[model samples]
Target chain A: MKVIVNGEPRELPDGASVADAVASVTTAGSGVAAAVNDEVVRRSAWEATPLRDADRLEVLTAVQGG
Target chain B: MERSASGVEHEPQEDMDSLVIAGEEVGSRLIMGTGGAPSMQVLREALTASGTELTTVAMRRVDPSARGSVLDVLNECGIRVLPNTAGCFTAGEAVLTAKLAREALGTNWVKLEVIADEHTLLPDPIELVDAAEQLVDDGFVVLPYTNDDPVLARRLEQIGCAAVMPLGSPIGSGLGIRNPHNIELIVERAGVPVILDAGVGTASDAALAMELGCDAVLLATAVTRARHPARMAAAMRHAVEGGRLARLAGRIPKRRYAQASSPFDGIATSQ
Candidate 1:
């Protein structure tokens, strides 16, 4: 299945969860929050939340700004 | 000057008041921003010099190969982090950003900025109020960045915003206090803390904001983009203190005629 992660398209195995998609881009224990299709997926549900084909995922963290 | 036994002059410490917002007492009235600094090292020094207890950071997509550490610098300095929704355009976007910030930073406090357009970067009052109401109901401490409108400020306060931050001018424009009367009106009517955010170009601008009865001032470009970040930060600290003190001291009324310093009868005749 193909999913867009942080505006970049990538191929992921079928039945891949949001946690799996997150792990493919960032190391474990990195401070980040994920949202699938504009809906925030809580940290606890990341492992259980499954991603479908063409799903838009946005993984964000804190950065310097006002 | 009062001299000590060792011949050193000891200055008495003035009684300084704390700024309380949403039950949190912050000793420093200057809320600094972490944007536009040349580097993290410079930001650390600037934050230290500013003596700000709370500094703002924006949420963005995580870069796997990112190197510098803003959180580390903030942690080492013991400054509290305030996550802001800088680029969000609508209520939904702002709410999502706030949620992400809460999850990432472990804080329910957010600086809500729902900008209307790219050129002005002003807040859309309709969407902003909607977002504030939603966030407040969701158990988040919402500090909205709004226009200098007293009605809107009161509306946000009515909706249970912890504080209302009205822009002095456009974001990053450095045009300080374009509508002081409007700011005064907001401060007069707002039940909650009124923070003067954005449009601060120099130390005097920060001071003037305080003198206008603002509980605090939030600025990024004025300090971070200055030629000397640390010095400007220190100046801003002093300006806030000075302005607050002056406001508390009660400024004299403006008069058309000059008041004579010397007694009229005490003048020596030049006969």
Candidate 2:
């Protein structure tokens, strides 16, 4: 399945959880957040939350700003 | 102010005062933002010199190649972080950004900023109100960056914002408090703390914000972009404390004519 991760399209295996999408990016243990289709998925639910095709997933963390 | 039986005048314990927002008491009146700094080392020095107990950081996409975390810097300094929803233009965007920040930073306090356009970087009053209401309902402590408009400030407060942070001018403009009367009016009527955020160019601006009765002053570019970030930060620290003290001391009223300091009856010259 194709999903947009952080504005970049990536191909992940079907039935991929948010954790998989997040793992496709950096593998930081802490200070990471996941959002699927503009809705936040709590850290505990990442493994349980499944992502389908064309899902907009945003993985964000703190940067120097605001 | 009071006088002891021995006639020694004593002033209020202004130094020990606290700036309270949503039941959180912050000892320092200066809140620093980690933007436009040359490096993390400089920011660390500035944050230390500014004496800010609480600071702000923005949330962005995680970079695989990114090195060093601002969170680590804050943690090393022992300063609490307040994540902000910057670069979001709509209520939904701000709310989602805020939620992401809460997830990433583990703090419910957010600096809600919804810019209307890129030209002036002004807050969209309509979008800001909507976002504040939503965030407040979602159990987040909202501190909105708004215009120096008293009416809008009041509206944000009525929407249950923890604090109304009115800009002195445009962000990073260094114009200082463009309308001090408006700030005064907002400070006068606001039930929550009024934080003077953005448009601060130097130490004097921070001091003036305090003197204008603001509970605290928040800035980034002013100190970060200065020739000497740490020095300016120290100056700001002193300015905020001094300004708060002046506000508590109460200045004398202005008069049309100057009164002679020495009474005529006490004049020694009889010419």
Candidate 3:
């Protein structure tokens, strides 16, 4: 399956979950949050939520800003 | 009684009045932004010097290769973080950003910013009001960064914003308060705390904002980009305190003619 991760196109396994997509992009101990199709998917639900083709996943974390 | 090294007697320090927002009391009236610092270490020091109990951060896509510890620095200083939606242009975008920030930062407080354009980075009043309504409905304590307009501030407050943050000018413009009257109007009408956000060029600007009846002042670039970040932060702390004191002390009314300090009966004759 193909999905858009952080505005970039990426290939993922057919049954890839939000957790898998997040794991591919970030390392352990990194504090991050994810949203699928503009709706937030809680950290606990990442492993259970499945992504479909062309699904947009926005993985974000805190950064210095005003 | 405590005496200084120079043998000057010092008055007892009074407890600072707390700034209450959304039922929470923060110790400092100055809210510092985490942006514009050269590094996390510098930001940590500045945050300490400024004595801000609440600071701001923004949420963005996590970069795989990115390496910095803003969160760690904030945690180390025990400063609470208020996430912002800086680049969001629409209500939907701002709401989503706030949600994401809540999930990531584990806080329901959001500094909702919906910029209209890139150049000025001004808030779209329509969009901002819509977003504030939505966020409040969603049970988030929304602190909107709005323009220095009394009507807009009232609208936002009527929609149940925890606080109304009116910008002194455009974001990072360093122009200071452009319309003191508008700010005063907002302060007069707003039931919630009025925070002067943005357009603070220096310590004096921060002080003036407080003197104009703002409950608090929020700034980032003025201190972070200063030649000495830590020193500037300390100066801002004092400025906020001084301004609040002056405002509470009741300044004399402005007059066209000068009032003589000495009594008329005590005048000395030259002849």
Candidate that would win on DockQ: 2
Clashing pairs in 1: none
lDDT tens per residue, model 3, B138-188: 999999999998999999999999999999999988999999999999998
Instruction: State the DockQ of every prediction.
Output: 0.81, 0.88, 0.84
| Lowest summed lDDT window (length 10), candidate 1 chain B | B8-17
Better of 1 and 2 by TM-score: 2
The residue ranges of model 2 lying beyond 4 angstroms of the native Cα positions read: B1-9, B12-16
Candidates 1 and 3 compared by DockQ, better number? 3
Model 2 residue B153 lDDT score? 97
Off by over 4 Å in 1: A28-30, B1-16
Per-model C-alpha RMSD: 3.2, 1.9, 3.1
iRMS per model, in Å, is 1.1, 0.7, 1.1
Q: Which of the CAPRI classes, incorrect, acceptable, medium or high, describes model 2?
A: high
Shift in Å, residue B124, candidate 2 = 0.2
| RMSD, candidate 3, Å | 3.1
Candidate 1, residue B27: Cα displacement in angstroms equals: 1.9
User: Which pairs in model 2 have colliding backbones?
Assistant: none
Residue clash pairs of candidate 3:
none
List TM-scores for all candidates, in order.
0.94, 0.96, 0.94
lDDT per residue (tens digit) for residues A6-51 in model 2: 9999999999999999998888898999999999999999999999
